[model samples]
Target: MESHTSVVLSLYRHGVTRENQEKIYIGWTDVPVAEEGIDLLMKTKANRPEAERVISSDLKRCVQSADYLFPEEKKIYHKGLREIHFGDWEGKKADELSKRKDFATWLEDPENMRPENGESFEEFSTRIQESWEMIREWCFQDGVKKIAIVSHGGPIRQLLTLLAPAEKPFWEWKPLHGQGITLYWQDAEAFRRGERCTSLSAVPIMEKENG
Candidate 1:
């Protein structure tokens, strides 16, 4: 929320977790990133611009990644930035639920309903919207012109709905592990009036660790 232009929002996803390597639905699972992921994050930290401040989800993977990237900076963590809660499906693999009727329905149309006691799409998006408003306020108050956010894919995708609506639907915006987009706005007025990102660009992930 700078006077000259909007803040540079560098949104980054957490690195690979064991569940991620296993291709599991890791919604709000609280798992740490693997060692390989840590190494990748350390390397990738060198690729991006220096951030004025850092924010992260309270989850383990995101917290760790933020600590690594901005060790000396004051890091803020909030639960609102966490991934969608899958409820009973928290740790299940995609293939494991491939045949379930609800899974198919949930996958086919995630916006209209919830997933087995999990948060509905509305719930998820609403939290993200509220969190983003809070984050923007923080930036405006602190005069923070550049910010970095480390979070999970679900929140990133949900936030993208506000940041880059034309990008794709939630599921279609499946950002890779340790990858996210940098969204730019014009100013506080544009941000408040709900303007889309002036530039929507992906931060490429490093080559996958040799498994």
Candidate 2:
């Protein structure tokens, strides 16, 4: 049998937006990264791995983030990579939703509850799964071994939950804005099987040193 090469995948959350600073839900709202956020994103290249391919959510924040970290690399953008569509909750703070009975119900059982005019947790997961399938095809047909993806918090968390070698709840895998994690698959078969990654590491965007 021929030996198969391994794969490395780096998944990053987009830099912070004004809505994020305000603790508002901005999923699908198309907000750009805040000014200070750009400074932080510029540091992502310091310790991050190089990639043969770069992918990002079509949303403004994610597109800008991928550009910052991999300026010369051509990138592929996809709407399927978007965060959970918050719909009516798109611009509201948690506190603003706190008093709504439906919001409370959704918080308690998000798997089964979706905000009015919004995506259910299952729906969001399904969309991400489709995106994962497309990525797998790229790996198989294109023989891609290294890839980077920049998306929102929710989608990043979902991808980690799906690929992390260790069992961790969705919330436990949180990557702050401008931060991310790298996942490794031992071989093409392992990746195709949808098995957990063989190992993982953090991809932190650290501060630059004083000149």
Candidate 3:
């Protein structure tokens, strides 16, 4: 891994989805972002014009977001950056799931709990970790000092655990739609949180045909 104090990563969550608007859990469904989401992505890209590389999950929503932001170039698509697989609960409502007896227990200890047909927390974390490793390699090889990644909330949350395992609660670190967290990786080993910026709600969505 190439190590440099100048390396920075901008992590962004995919824009609003139909599930988000409907208040449903959209774990790994290959959903597309709403028109509002496309606008948010364009604004995000404008806000970070200095980014040299753009990467995103292979899922439809993320790919759409990345395409809107960096339409001229091909983005790095990594399956490891995809959202958590909710298994049988892929499109269910949170409140509905919470009504079940196993819901509270599952939420309390997600690291070990697995939804009826969904992935365990450990499985999700491991997938993101693998993506992180790939990210490091890409940064090193390209000598990239700054890069932007568009992905789902689950992967972003998991990446936070790898970068900053100690300060805030998991709930507190979750990335909202169109929000971004900046991280610094020095000498290929030292990782730390940088300033986090939220421009999703502040920016206007650009109206463009879907790619």
Candidate 4:
């Protein structure tokens, strides 16, 4: 077999919004960055990596953050990298949904019972994985080895959960807003197989002296 080709992905969670500040489950909601999140997002810029290209979720928050972080790089807007659609719960805070049994069920088994009209974990993972394959294929064919992805927490979490060295659940690998993680894939095929690659230490947005 041919030796595996490597690729580096610098994945970032987009800046926050007023809904995020209000502790709302802000998924599939097109809103701009909030006042408080401005400073947090700026910190991410200081930790920027040299990327061959930029890809962003089509959501306003990610698109705006991508432009701010990488003003010169070409941005490819893709909806496949969007946050999991919250559907009826798009704007509801966690506290507001704490009493709903469906919420509890979703927490335990998201693949079985999802939010009303929202995507199940299975569906979300499938689409994201497919999109990821396409992105990697495009990059590999173009002689690209590194790229930056500006996206939401949900998609970033999936990448982490799938790429983590040890097995973990969704909530266990939560990435903060504007925070990120770098994935070192064994090869492009690893992404398609959903196989774990080398373990990368989590990349925090505001942490200093990350050596």
Candidate 5:
């Protein structure tokens, strides 16, 4: 018998895109996954967990990844799950922005600085928190035991920093393209409270089939 209080949450980063390969800031840009990323995901699909529910960002990259990874599962898309809006920096690389004084200031205190026309880190985190609360409520209502979330690197990292059992900084929780982490919660109370999960494990990865 399944415990109603227990839930498994897997957070998968969308496959890499051309902008990712180019090391550009791609928040809210809506790019498709690259060929290389698709191939890699295809090879690893067998290892991904089967979930009762799948949630995803509405952005093109994450939506495409959910199709590749959870082909049979119906997905709930949320714009709030989207990556932080990079605003003026969208599609630009760090080196290109490095010369700007605003960029340097943002790097030092991103929580307080908003890229001209971009979302401040504080705003982004607040959006994510709301999205997460919604997801938890949905799980409770639907009696979901396992759930998968397909999102961008920034959003996934932010989630892990908040929920992973270990005490890791935001950047330290980075998940590679098409990869994810699984968090196990023994009680729904912790999930509802947005407390850290009791345990966590890396989602298994298999090498590309043709490689």
Candidate 6:
């Protein structure tokens, strides 16, 4: 029954790459953040004081977002938190890929589908779960009550789907761009149990035009 204190703040993908801006699926491309992406991170930090400590993926966009939002000394880069590698489809257009039978199956039940040459969804899920455990341990050891993580949409969605199962439609579980979810772990047992203090409202969505 011992109580432990920690918080998990997850940031969705930011800073659209040229491919992204072109509406392409730039999965696992290690693209850097766009100028507007830096602005978005700056604005987020200016509004959320709890985001003082940042853990980000080693990818360029994530690293750039972290560097812009947090002081250099306060940032930590974790490779385990990187995006799901999309293999041969790394920079393909989503619309074009969606027409493929395999892609349709992937969209229907991602758990069973593996993109050509890419890691399976199960593999990506396992890595993300491991990263979460590491973060939880670090937070407990350091008595950290709040922390921020900058990572890709795929991992963020995976975590959210695991943490907060949707009562409505399954599609509702997806995480939006630049959006975040705040999770509070009251104690070690509750943390282990995956209990949260409460779920906060979605991060205010920036206009798509602005993005």
- Please name the candidate that would achieve the greatest TM-score relative to the true structure: 2
Report the candidate with higher lDDT, 3 versus 6: 3
Q: Which lDDT tens digits does candidate 1 get at residues 1-211? A: 4456666788888988888999888788889999878877876676665689899999999999888777778998899999888887888999998988999998778888588978888898899999999887777777787788999888887788668837677777877676657877767566655667677677654564677
TM-score of each: 0.88, 0.95, 0.80, 0.85, 0.93, 0.80
Model 5 C-alpha lDDT per residue in residues 1-211, reported as the tens digit of each score: 1344787899988988999999889899989999988977776577887799999999999999999999998998999999999899998998999999999999998878999899989899999988998888878767787899999888888888888887898877769898878899998766766789999988888775573
* Tens digits of per-residue lDDT for model 4, 31-87: 998766667777777776668979999999999888777878899999999998878
Ranking by lDDT: 2, 5, 1, 4, 3, 6
**Which tens-of-lDDT digit does each residue in 1-211 have in candidate 3?**
3444556677888889878988787888878899877667776666544467888898998888887767776688888888888887778898888887766788887777888888888888877887787776667667677777889887887767556525555556768796576765444434322322212222233345577
RMSD of 6: 3.9
Off by over 4 Å in 4: 1-6, 185-195, 204-211
Model 2, span 96-196: residue lDDT tens: 99999998999898889998899989999999989988887776678788889999888888898888988888878778898778999888778877888
Clashes of each: 0, 0, 6, 0, 0, 1
Report lDDT (CA) for all predictions: 0.81, 0.88, 0.72, 0.79, 0.87, 0.68
For model 1, how big is the CA root-mean-square deviation? 3.1
Poorest 10 consecutive residues of model 6 by lDDT? 162-171
Poorest stretch of ten by lDDT in candidate 3 = 192-201
Q: Model 5, 36: alpha-carbon shift in Å?
A: 0.9
Whole-model lDDT, model 6:
0.68
Indicate the residue-level lDDT of 71 in model 3: 77
What is model 3's C-alpha RMSD? 5.2
Q: Model 2, residue 108: what's the lDDT?
A: 91
